[model samples]
Target: MSAAHVPVLLAEVVDALQPRAGETIVDGTFGAGGYSRALLAAGSSIIAFDRDPGAAQFAQGLPADRFRLLERRFSELDAVTGPGAVDGVVLDIGVSSMQLDQAERGFSFMRDGPLDMRMAADGPTAADLVNAAEPAEIARILYVYGEERESRRIARAIARRREEQPFTRTLELAEFIEKTLGGRRGAKVHPATRSFQAIRIAVNEELAELEAGLVAAESALKVGGRLCVVTFHSLEDRIVKTFLAVRAGKTPGGSRHAPPVETTAAPSFQLSFNGARTASAAELAANPRARSAKLRAAVRADAPVWRAAA
Candidate 1:
């Protein structure tokens, strides 16, 4: 793992969790075991999960009794570790710096390598999605996940290029996007950045996993237990924000003219703070990835879990 791959929101996450001796906390991301290490230092038992097998290799030599690592995604958390049993659950959602730093992982357009961007290293790669997805479907992924404005144009370019020669390498895809979108001249951000983000998210099913994981986390947490999520992009942050708001019953009030309805399901969570928190300027200076991170936390309310609307 690269030394530069420091976990974002480390201090804030640890402080929010407030782990205590004998308490069991779940580090749902387990990227580089940064948060897990801190929790262990605080004398809390940790159950850490990472879908990436590479991360498990790095976790060797860690105290086995105090910390246990699971080779699973956070969405499968409830299935593996029974529901409503944890004291707290922390998820650092989206791609990890470890995956992005290694060019072989093919997450970064800045470095040239194979166009593979599988977090697990054994799943469908970015190349597969880009080469096979329909133009409309590709456009939708870019728009929704990457928030790319020129999604249609970019998708069209990708479709056109792949017909002549399918992209197999990172720079091949990146250079195609750059040339088609107009390379570096006065570009605030790289032209290929959003396109790469869209493909990676699609390849990993990141948004879907996040949604499922949020629901699973809510169900898995005990009443009064906390769920803390750190999101680095707007799409993920928006989902986290809305999920917490809905659970806290913070929805806009109904008009007085409307008939009052009896409550069938109790609100399951209360916001730990008024709004999301960001890292300190000092932290951002040390880790640039921390700049975009937003932390949202909520404590489970003393109520039964509410099923999704049918």
Candidate 2:
């Protein structure tokens, strides 16, 4: 299969979801239709979503009666499917392989293209932020989202350089950052990787979208419904981990002096399995992208969905 068609942890996600005949599933991040296609083959109707306008092309061959694609953010899932409706929701987080492979989409520094990293077509491009944002804000985005320690120095350099000429292309900023960081020093990953990831996340508002989508999934799933999330980076995985832990009532520690926290909010979900599942060694050999991928799943409990504090 082509890289674009290879969904990470496909079999594992399907097994976790256990899509039965006549059931409905929400493929929240319908990147290349990999999970949606597999679920349909398993006899479940699919409600798939993708923010990218280009994603519709992949839905052409799917049976209209069994599958429907929504050109909207997955965070609005509950709005489309009422509370306690769908049987399953599966989300594959981060930029799709299809987007990275296309140069004009500008999701990858390895490719020469416009520095437009918005997941949807409507938002501010990466170039806009790189060229216009204050240096401190840029530094914070790199530090918090990318976990890059050299964020301040890089941001300062970017501010200095953009004064001469604005960054418009992906490789232009990448090579500049690489030089500012004093070359790779033989690191296995490219020097610009973290900065690129940070910019992409900021441009797309990905982490916030993820948190909202998870809450939407909770509101949309019926009792015993399955929710599976495949996260590609530590930030995404951390959010999923914390969300599940809190919802499952597995949060660590409550003070003896304080009231027991269990009474505050009932458990909304039960863990499908302990910890997170990583790609098997055999599967790892076939797809390098799966190296950082982790899958976490849970079954919806018969309790009300937890609402956020005012």
Each prediction's Cα lDDT score? 0.85, 0.93
Over 1-310, each residue of candidate 1 has an lDDT whose tens digit, in order, gives: 3547557887888888888888888899998988888888899988898989888876877789988998888898877668788888999988888788789999999999999999885888899999999999999999877889999999999999899999999998899888988888997889989889889888989988998998888878888888899998888887788778777887534333222233546689999997899989899788778889999999988877776431
- Report the error of model 2 at residue 204, Å: 0.4
Q: Stretches of candidate 2 above 4 Å error?
A: 1-4, 253-263, 308-310
Could you tell me the TM-score of candidate 2? 0.95
Model 1, which residues run further than 4 Å from truth?
Answer: 1-5, 252-264, 308-310
Please report the candidate that would top TM-score against the real structure: 2
List the pairs of residues colliding in candidate 2. Answer: none
Cand. 2 Cα-lDDT: 0.93
lDDT score for residue 115 of model 2: 95
RMSD of every prediction:
3.8, 3.1
lDDT at position 147, candidate 1 = 84
